[model samples]
Target: MMIHTEPGIIKRDGVYFCSSDSFTQDNLFYILWGAVYSLDSPYRVSRSYMDAFMLQYIVSGELNFVLRGKTFTAKANEAVLLNCREKNLYWADRQAVVKWFHFNGKNTLPLLNYIYERNGGTGLFKKNYTKKIEPYIDSILNEIHKKDSNVFSISHNIYSILCELSAPPAVLESPAEKTIREALSFIQSNYSKSISVNDIAAHVSLSTYYFTRLFSKYMHLSPHTYLLSTRLEAAKKILIYTFEDIETISLRTGFQSSSHFIRAFKKANNITPNNFRKVFYQKSID
Candidate 1:
């Protein structure tokens, strides 16, 4: 495929190209190239005819596309896949970044057709469903860079991702489910803030009582417990990777105080923050 109209990206973006033998081409789904690109708005692709299926997961900003006489937009956390051989057009309508790839295989086109038909002739996957498959895509992206690419495993993962895309609920999402999804996304973004259950419920426009019931029903954890778990996880990473003081780490991770942080961490991990750090350091030295 030709990059027919790119002024250039705003930042340095990296990509890897993969080559496969005849057996792989005949048997496995294989990546042609993949990258995490921070693209400029003026970037566009109208040229076609290189035969492959293009899949992109938007990380930020927006992308607009015209495929099979239909137009669509992919926002952050959404995904789009289409046949590259079609008379299609797609561009970054705003400054956008994505984890994307062009892949080819014996059965790729058939799988794409199934996925499009399943979604009523569209390839856009909503944020909720795409979340389920990002880890598999991450694996494929990492494997494509290895000295000896695991073609079989990559093929399985690509097939798994496609299979997931091909299966959305009969009805896209229920109102309750959508509410919970929005709440989860909000928590991911705001977990570093000193936010409470009330704050979270307010953000989602629900009463605290109802929201707590719904959150527990869906996630099997109370909002308070989940929030504390998020903070503790962040503190653990800090303890292992940085020399930041425990108090600073506690405050930054949204804990009310260092003592509270220590108590919670020990309850969760059976070890204090300082002891955890020392153990990690000792392991590295050993």
Candidate 2:
């Protein structure tokens, strides 16, 4: 989508970057545009139609967003993802600093659908995940400042930011459920490292036997199976989205060896990793 601000709006101080045509043509996931604005006076923007999805985070003050004729207020540490095709208006309730990213690609719609389903069809919500999102925003801004920013790096950071947003809301977990959830979070964050079921159990301060039973009951899979599945899932995403070779992919996904990765991948997917990658690229090309 073209990037243009409405005329006759109050002036604000901001830094922004728009993706180049070459970058947009080659990347499946990309930020079409982004901006960080610090308003000295009141600011407002109205749009009848925006061609890409937008994620806006409030940094210091509050924003009043009107979408579908409903008004919602987002304050510091909160965010909203607007379906840009809809009519919307957002204005600062007072002087505020805000950061926003406009993103689109093949994966965007499906990811948005998943988020909407989990969020009860609402576009505004509190940021319940950890506080690492701000650093990611800084990283994106730094990358954009480079004379030749790597598209992959910026895109990957954007994906990380979205993943943080799309995480399920914080729930009050029972003691057992909390322990299991901690273990699962560890597995997800460290799957690429050389970690074992014993290590996972130890991190959660549980005996191997007890941990195995609890995990199975809660997750419907043994801890070992869960770790393996996590690794395999990471491998699959890398294979489909990146050009890393089989050996590199194996190492990155925590497999002991390329041959072992191949065997496990074939057993799980009913096709070799190479074949899976080929099929994915072929579909993208078609």
The number of the candidate with the highest TM-score is 1
Tens digit of per-residue lDDT, candidate 2, span 1-286: 3334443234443446656566464565676667777753356687888778887878877888887567888888877888788888887657677777777776777888787777766677786642657777777776766668777777787788778778777787799998998999999998898999999999999999999999999999899999999999999999999999999999999999999999999999899999999999999999
> In candidate 2, what residue range of length 10 has the lowest lDDT sum?
1-10
lDDT of each: 0.86, 0.80
TM-scores vs. true structure, each candidate: 0.59, 0.54
TM-score of candidate 1 versus the correct structure, residues matched by position: 0.59
- Cα error of candidate 2 at position 188, Å: 27
Can you write out model 1's per-residue Cα lDDT over 1-286, one digit (the tens) per residue? 5667656367634578888899999998988988888877788888567788888898889889888779999899998887888878888767888888889999998888888878867678888778988898899889888888888888888888988888844575889899999988888788878899999999999999999999999999998898888888888899999999999999989988999999999999898999999999999899
Residue pairs in candidate 1 whose N, alpha carbon or C atoms collide under 3 angstroms: none
Error of 1 at 134 (Å): 0.8
CA-RMSD of model 2: 15.1
